[model samples]
Target: MLLAILLPFLSFMIRGKIITGIICLILQFTLIGWLPAAIWAALSLQNARAEKRNEKLIRAIKENSK
Candidate 1:
């Protein structure tokens, strides 16, 4: 919940997704586009988290097989 609200700002501050953050920042200024931007940020964050989880799981499986 809180993450969705802060993601756009954090993305820019952390320099993770500069382009997406910039687009969201610009959309935020429009007021109406803010929701879409936030939604986009949230979805992006979710995908990143899932990818990280997958990587960790793969690493664990590889270590156990050895």
Candidate 2:
């Protein structure tokens, strides 16, 4: 079971293919259980929100500079 989940990630790591790696990771998490998926989803959402806030701050700084 661990091998099954690790295979895709290992392949992706070898190939350095990020999209497939992420897809495989999500699939593995889903197949194993929902907790990891939920935690990662929450973290992803938080990071997205942080990025948006950073973008807003950057825009404000640019506007003030102008």
Candidate 3:
């Protein structure tokens, strides 16, 4: 139990990226065997969502300006 908890924290302690840490944290709860894979998956999905949201907001602002 402690190691499962510590694995994600260890990744953080090593100064890994924020999204990577977040994914590891999730994997600790969800998929014990695929923590590393989950990290990449989470990061990619989070980034894509953020980018799409940003683009939508930009478009909205541009339309409002006209």
RMSD to the true structure for each prediction, in A, is 2.1, 8.8, 8.7
TM-score of 1: 0.77
How many angstroms is residue 63 displaced in model 2 relative to the true structure, after the best TM-score fit?
0.4
Candidate with better lDDT, 1 vs 3? 1
What lDDT tens digits, residue by residue, belong to model 3 across residues 1-66? 233334644444355457665666666675644665445544555676699999999999999999
Q: Please give the range of 10 consecutive residues that has the lowest summed lDDT in model 2.
A: 1-10
Residue 34 alpha-carbon offset, candidate 1, angstroms: 0.6
Candidate 3 at 59: error in angstroms?
0.3
TM-scores of all predicted structures: 0.77, 0.53, 0.48
Best by lDDT: 1
lDDT of 1: 0.73
* Model 1 lDDT tens row, 1-66: 366665565654464766767777888887788778777777777788899999999999999999
Model 3 clash tally, residue pairs: 0
Largest TM-score belongs to which candidate? 1
lDDT computed for candidate 2: 0.57
